[model samples]
Target: MNLFDRLLLFILSVVALVLGVAVVLVGAAVPIGWAQMELTRHPYNIVTMVVGGVTALIAIRFLFFRRRRDPKLDSVMVAGDHGPIRIAYDTIVQLANRRGSQLKGVASFETVVRQGQGGLVLTLHMRVLPDIDVAALAKEAQNAVKSYLEETTHVPVERVLVQVTELGDNNRSMRVWSGTGA
Candidate 1:
């Protein structure tokens, strides 16, 4: 959650907790004159009932609610003759996927693009062939993805992170025959 959202929730929770405690105290006959007087009068009853109901609702909602995070990536601005062109986030991801697919050792991959301070950061989760050199392949994939994305989208790539999640066995036999699998 953001700072402002957390702060608002904190304030609301504190208010609700205090009001709830007061209501409970009055209900239990704690002998607080103001609460007793407020509870006894008809007009004050309406006010308390409304406030108590609202507070209960807010408390239940905030406590039980799960906030979903936004999955959309930030839009990129491009210079156009008439005006600025806004590029959708999915387009960048698509470009990254295409670039990553062209890498020889990759069996499958997923791409995530996000806006960073420097510019865009692209993270690739890739499963590759077990026979390849992981370090060299990762470096090459990073460079290729970075260069292709920047060149194709004209968006500056802050970083291209290639995480090798799995190394498949498809090319192991070929590498073994070629004496390079080890």
Candidate 2:
């Protein structure tokens, strides 16, 4: 649950606990001054009952129906000769990035790794240098990333999807020469 929900639940729980204790004390006929004066009165008793009932219901709903966050998969397990080996997804993605970035045409890139039934699926989103062949670069990137991850992690790579998102020489300076330029 979120912070606000948790805080509201806590407040409701405290109120419910206090109300329960007061009810028990009143039922047991312990002569508390506030209980005798306030609780025994007409409007105060009704308002207290309504507020207590609503608080109890809200607390129950919060406890039972709170939103659950999906668990993030940090690592994948691979079978080995001795037993099993755990490889972190971050390591796999880093390897893919290393191989992809090493290619000549690649300027910069971001990668994502998804766990598939047979193995891992890698997706690369990249920016390439101007005048580079985007289609060739994308194909090369897919093969490079797939082979590198499979070899390094010893895990099957189901697919590698590459997208050439941008084409630019980010390090190059551009000069706009007007007709009256120096």
Instruction: Specify the highest-TM-score model's number.
Output: 1
Runs of candidate 2 exceeding 4 Å displacement: 1-72, 170-182
lDDT of 2 by residue, 1-182 (tens): 57897888777776776775565444445345755676656445555556656655665565565555443466788889999888888888788888988887677878898888888888898988876678988998988888877778899999888878887565653421122435
Cα TM-score of candidate 1: 0.68
- TM per model? 0.68, 0.59
Candidate 1 ranges beyond 4 A from true positions: 1-10, 21-53, 59-73, 169-182
lDDT of each: 0.75, 0.74
Give per-residue CA lDDT, model 1, range 25-81, as digits (tens).
455544467666766764455465566666766776775666675544357887778
Candidate 1 CA-lDDT value: 0.75
